[model samples]
Target: MIHTRALTKDFTVGRGEAVHAVRGVSIDIEPGELVAVLGPNGAGKTTLMRMLTTLISPTSGEATVAGHDIATHPARVRRRIGYVGQGNGAGHTQRVHDELYTQGEIYGLDRRAARTRADELIEALDLGALRERKVSDLSGGQRRRLDVALGLVHAPPLLFLDEPSTGLDPQNRANLWEHILRLRERHGMTVVLTTHYLDEADTMAERVVIVDHGRVIADDTAEALKTKLAGDRLTVGSPDVRTLSRLAEALPGARDLASSGERLELRVSDAPTAAAELLFAARDAGVPVTAVQSHRPTLDDVFLTLTGRSLREESSEVSK
Candidate 1:
């Protein structure tokens, strides 16, 4: 549904120094696929989206979105895809239903068609109660749902969401995701979204693309990336901390060993087998084991493995 090659975007500041917002990023997204783009603040994932959506021109390279060249056929691309940006796209004074209808008309739908689309979206996104309410009066989650409705007013085949669930609480986030998934399934839309929520990206998106310093650092299915880059993690607590650390250090396939208090944690290729071996070795050495637990690798682990930093910490800093 979308393809890019060496897509680059640069900006010049007051001192004439160039800022490389997006540098040589090349990626392909297939139709009917839900892909999540992840990165820290100023990582250029948003820049890449803007270029693809025709909101900004790329400094270099080329892209085709929804079967049209983004550079040469921007209008066609816009017609074929919907974009819901980080900020609410609805006007504050407008009624919820009015906002959706207006957006449809702006996209060239006639009055009747726009109204029909507005009603369809209101029913689909569960905005019936707020149909007459002003956009400003809606809560954060309500406003976000309206924003999604606005983007889908045109019924585009592809949709681009830029952090659609940034500030909502857990329930609202899950609600919004449910609506998004239902809409995608109903319309057969190709979804490409950027999110700071690691768990959301891991569980919701079929594919994950990690961007850093304006480059595409990693791209694969979330599970594949985790399994290939970061294996399972083991957390062990023992009364004999010194002996447990020594034994854990010598375990095969172990990496990133860490210790705190009486607990030690490490990443290994196989956590179940590694934990078993460590427990037996500790038993033979007469080191008492208190507890042992193993966990599957998360998307943040994949980011840390690639960039040597925590994605959660970086995202929190960006929020700050």
Candidate 2:
């Protein structure tokens, strides 16, 4: 549903100092695919989304969204896609149902059809409870759901969500995703979202694209990237840190060995085999193994391995 080739965008600030927001980003997304773009502050993720959604034209390269060329057929692209940006659109004092119906009418739906779509969305997004409430009076989660319902008023084939669940609580975030998943399943929708939550992308996205400095650094399934780049972190705790360090150094495929006061941590591809071998070697060398634990790699671990920086830290900066 989406294709891009070397797409790039550059902006000029004060005194013509250029800011390259997106750099040579090439991606292909199949129909009905749920793809998440992962990145930190000023990572060009928003710039890329803007270009794909036809909100901004690229400085270089080409892209087609939903079978329409973004540069030439922007109107068609807009008609075929629904974009729910980070900002809320239903911030006005209009009633929830009226706001949605107006949105449907704005999309060229007839009076009856617009009202019908509005009612359908109210039911689909579980906004029936808030139907009579003014948008300005609804809670953050309720507002977000209303925003989503507005985006789908026309039922576009593709949807672009920019940080759809940024400020919501954990319960609301979970509820939002449940509604989004249901919409996708019901319509076989193609969803492309950019999110700062590592776990959200890890668990929800079928494929992930990691962006940094306006460029895509990694793209793969979350599990595959974790396994290939980060592996598993094995921390063996013992009073004798020296023996733990020695065991880690002698083990095959054990890298990044570090001693933290009394515990030794290392990166290993096979956690089970490495843990077992460490215990056996400790027994032979007269080193007592106090405790053994293996932590499976997360998307943050994969990001740290690739960029040598914590995505969580950068994301916090973005939130600020």
Candidate 3:
């Protein structure tokens, strides 16, 4: 339940140079949809989220969140969306239950309803035992969950999570994912999240949007995005460099051919069909192929293929 048209955000760094954090981006998110925004750090994913959540105004363009015009009805938009930002929210001295109760009250919930929601969320988020514990004493994962509980204390229809699983262990990350899925399944809540974990996006999101250089690069279903990189990767182990070179020449779409120890790695569009050709070619050339393995392209492959670099690499470059 979010729509944006030609959204742009620019800031003047100094003299006259302007840094365009978000550039002419437009997207539509339907109700009850779990949309994952994938991007490098400076890809403007967070900036766009801020615009949608009414935390910041766009320099130009229009947006409607939960049927409220973000420019004119930001208060209504805020009331409809729960935003758990990158930073944690609960004060260090505030107890878990108190933090949630205060959040509910800020949203205009009565004491009875606030207490009820606090109790419910404390249990739902597995913070019942820590209800009386101060937030500073909680572990990173626990604190993150408490932040989410505070955000949802009012039970907003839409949730914006920016790297919600940051610093979480594998178990806690999976647990958070389960909670997010349940929110959608039971409450029909719309979730929009940004994450560095490609597997998380692959498993959780119904739609994937990739942004690069402050622009929308690709948007599609997770499967469809991976299919866009449709192909197989082949890794061959051989001692001879000549054999690897010969195999690369015979294989279509083979690039970045390199030798590591006794193995050669290169990318190919079709692994099953190409592996056989590679084997025969190596055989005729008297070069022995020790092992061959093929794997379908992953979301990382799609991102690297489209951007000529990995997501983490792009993010690092942006920070520089």
Candidate 1 lDDT for residue 28: 87
| Per-residue alpha-carbon lDDT of candidate 1 for residues 1-320, written as tens digits (9 for 90 to 100) | 99999999999988989999999988888899999999887899898999999999999999999999999999999988999999999999999988888898899999999999999999999999999999999999999999999889888999999999999999999999999999999999999999879999999999999998999899999989998999999999987788898998888889888889999999998899999999999999999999999999998999999999999999988788
* lDDT per residue as tens, model 2, 1-320: 99999999999999999999999999999999999999987899999999999999999999999999999999999988999998988856799999999989888999999999999999999999888888889889999999999889988999999999999999999999999999999999999999989999999999999999999999999999999999999999888889768878888789999888878999999898999999998888888878899999999999999999999988887677
Clashes of 1: 0
- Candidate 3 lDDT (Cα, 0 to 1): 0.86
| Alpha-carbon RMSD of each model | 1.4, 1.1, 2.6
Residue 304, model 1: Cα distance from true site in angstroms:
1.3
Clashing pairs in 1: none
Ranked by TM-score from best down, the candidates are 2, 1, 3
Better of 2 and 3 by lDDT: 2
The C-alpha stretches of model 3 lying farther than 4 A from their native spots are 239-262, 284-286, 314-320
For model 2, the stretches where C-alpha displacement exceeds 4 angstroms are: none
Model 2, residue 119: C-alpha shift (Å)? 0.4
What is residue 6's positional error in candidate 2, in angstroms?
A: 0.8
Worst 10 residues of 2 by lDDT: 243-252
Clashing residue pairs in candidate 2 (N, C-alpha, C atoms within 3 angstroms): none
Candidate 2: RMSD over Cα atoms? 1.1
